[model samples]
Target: MRQKTQRRWRILRRIDAESRALAETLGIHPVSACVLLNRNLTEPAALQHFLNPSLESLHDPYLMKDMDKAVARLRQAIDGQERVMIHGDYDVDGVAATAMMVRMLSALGVDVTHHIPHRVDEGYGVSAEGIRQAAANGVKLVVTVDCGISAYEEALLARELGLDLIITDHHQPPPAFESQIAYFGAAVAVLNPNRPDCGYPFKGLCGCGVAYKLATALVENLGHPGNALQRAYLDLTALATIADIVPLRDENRAIAQFGLERLSDTKKPGLKALMGVCGIAGKRLSSYHVGFVLGPRLNAAGRLDTAETALNLLLTRDDSEAGRLADALNQLNRERQEEESSTLQDAELMIESGADALGGDILLDSDKALVLASEDWHMGVVGIVASRLAERYVRPTILITMGEDEGKGSGRSIRAFDLKKGLDGCADYLVGYGGHAQAAGLTVTRGQLSQFRARFLQVADEQLGADDLIPVVDIDCELGPRDLTFELVNELRRFEPYGHENPGPVFAIRGAKLLDQCTVGANGKHLKLRVGFWEASYDALWWRKGDNFGRFSRHQLLDLCFSLDINEYQGIPSMQFVVKDVQPS
Candidate 1:
């Protein structure tokens, strides 16, 4: 774990006293006032927009680069009654996007088929074999969501085979690839927010979010703004946006907020049943629900078997089958969790024994470029395990699982390093590699392991600094006992659906007296404490903080940073602080 530091508090300066006056004048809570102050939501209009998140504020879908061409091509295909296939990645984001496209096109009476590439065999995006398969099935046009940005060779092959492709992806492009080669060997409308040529603002949309935009453009162009089928696909957009862990701000924030509303009455049987099984039914499902509950279940099918299971689950309208599939996915999730834990434990053990000896940015090599392989390691769970290892070790962690005659590697990197770029720098040793800066995958020959390790570490040593290896906590503002209130908590809702870049605000409170304390939850994993000044008691719960019991006590003065949350039990609403940290004074 990165060591914690106690520093002098710096209040966010952007918030003037007017926000506080607004809170006081409007009978809003001070906590909400602080939240507003922290996010620099000082302007009345901005505050109003944050408070009233509506679809009207959303940017035009056509603002996306190539959105016009993509919609035009799709309309042409629909008008021509041409066979079109929705090519999607195997992950949750890709699958959800695929489902969204399929639903919309089918509603429009377009002949549409959806195809998800197998993670193990086809890897990601548009594969050569997948294109051939689509052609064999009479698919003349293909729209790829969440992938195909890096499939230059596959796109070339598809063009030769007489297929038309539209690429919609959000991953950063390789320096060498300026534009995505569409299926017809020519660069068609490649809609990627990360492309330098694209001028549309808000570059952090998830693949499914991009797909939803495309669908919206298509529907709007078709002059059907009130199309029920068009709006129904927002739930998929919400699922993918949250699942992909993109920054939930601006357009993404609106999509997630709107999507959650629709998800409450979602038409997808598999999703409804999955939520039921996970016990999130009738509760306010946040981005956390998508990440922890829904995403993993959908991902399990792709990881353990094929993504088709998840795609079918989303597309299937049958209730009984949805129940059965939900059960199967739940079981798969449990099995996956077990595999992840065991693999993580084994990796930890390996590090404990020799990690220190071979330190300087970890390079755990065996016969493969990375030796995450164990008899117990499930291939589907390795990427997550690798990410976890990277988070803990502060290194570019590569988890390799032994495959027949070759080894597959999944890597996760820190902010200072780019995994894909680094892998691209050492492309001679790798057979194939593709991913974003923070996460990537590659295949390496056993003979190239040593050379790859040396090259990777050299790149890290040259680029990274000591501070880059350590995690930094950036607090939004400072607060006192009198500052936290129910009204304040309500105001904080302006920052709802927080993820990635626009994280929920973390506020620091110094010299707070701990009035009461206890451990609760299953396995006593959570810590609860009443903190306050005289006559003011604010309840706080630290999920997964029992491990830090040694540092906390009742009646002790402490400094803490936390975000306010509301807990509704039996229809009674109560406020709670989701504690981020607590340091004894």
Candidate 2:
């Protein structure tokens, strides 16, 4: 289906003869081989690991920087019976990481508790208040999960309070601190693969992935089996790994694959209850289920209320408590949906009424980035709005909720722009900021709102070009209607748990006849069509495109790009197309 805004479709080059041979050698389809080759997985070992992920695929946890030190400190805490508090962020990644650390440490008989900060109150990263509370509770050690990379002050505070601090995070660190472990935020150990000096082979671990590493190291250090403990933590690692939107390759992919398998029959009462509430219990789960279905519900706790609720859900062993917590999360998710839609509508209205737009009111015209702020905006939901705006407008988008004297904003960016690095360029305007390249959070004084917007847009203009602004739909391969078969679909299933860099393969078919069309679903918001290639006909669904129902006619010849899918109804399975884009021939 065509829209006013045309997305750039880039088809990857077809695989060569050698790749076809590799496919034969691997006993897989050429399409699967092409997808693997597109990701530059030409080596035999990498291909085998990807095809059949196993415990051997995971790297040694000791490879991460400061892992040994972190493990030793944890041993001391265990042997001496020292009190420990785990400091974690409020998002899905943070909560999962926290839950994993707390559970694993408790299993090892360490005196451990966790603190998940309130989003609106404590904001992101390690908070000084949390450290103070831990000290007040006589906690002698503080371990952070999914946060503390930029907590120089908080780390120092922990030290002054006579508490040993260990920082476990995966966010990009300050450039100057890459080689200088001595300045690792005054913490005894900082375990982040992104650290330049760290020799970890894979650098795309999420917060929970790093925390899992520490857990495994501790298990092996304490003279227990590593793989068994690793398996024990995969469910949480998988949840955070997918939720955090890290690259799904290397060890991250293995964790996701194995984790989804474990999540299917999770023994955790909280996870089981959550899956029941989400209506996904006893079903084969995928990355889609984790990232879209479960992640948001877990995230809703933090976005609308306290993330402690979600953390509590994960930690709870009692079935009744899990049921109550899951129900609470479900309700919070509904509220979150309403708030997100309301905030998104407000941002859209602001853009539509250009007068309300900051930075000289050039939002829809010359501006390369979107910087929107409003006192009426909810601080917790602005990040979701920023994500929608960034994806819809194909620009780096920042949505801020203005406070009395300052504003807290979340920014999401496209491939062309590195959001954290861009924020680094605007450091003069920001009060503080920390996050990944694609997503980040920041603080700015109300006075500097306009200046920060202008500078941010300027940086974007310098970095992005006209082509970079266009969203690219990367087509992995082009195939005929006859190529769509159960075998091919099964092969595609092998690439499950896809996210970020390893998205589901997109396929393109040229000159398919549009046989019939109609709007389906509630409010007639979805487009359903009968698409055919010669005598081969298949049902296709174009979600959220009912507005274009009358745009095409019967027997129309069109080029369609879609992902192949299977629809099962009444114990019958058939091939179908999940349409992406359509163009007239």
| lDDT for each candidate structure | 0.77, 0.87
Per-prediction count of colliding residue pairs? 4, 1
* C-alpha RMSD by candidate, in order: 3.9, 1.9
TM-score of 2: 0.96
Per-residue lDDT of 29 in model 2 = 82
lDDT of 1 by residue, 426-498 (tens): 8887777888788888877656765776777667777777666665456776766666677666666656787
Question: Could you tell me which residue pairs clash in candidate 1?
Answer: 29-487, 29-488, 31-488, 32-488
The local distance difference test score of model 1 is 0.77
Deviating ranges (above 4 Å) for candidate 1? 1-49, 179-184, 226-230, 355-376, 418-424, 514-522, 530-532, 536-539, 550-554
Candidate 2: residue pairs that collide? 1-582
> Candidate 2, which segments miss by more than 4 Å at Cα?
1-3, 176-185, 357-360
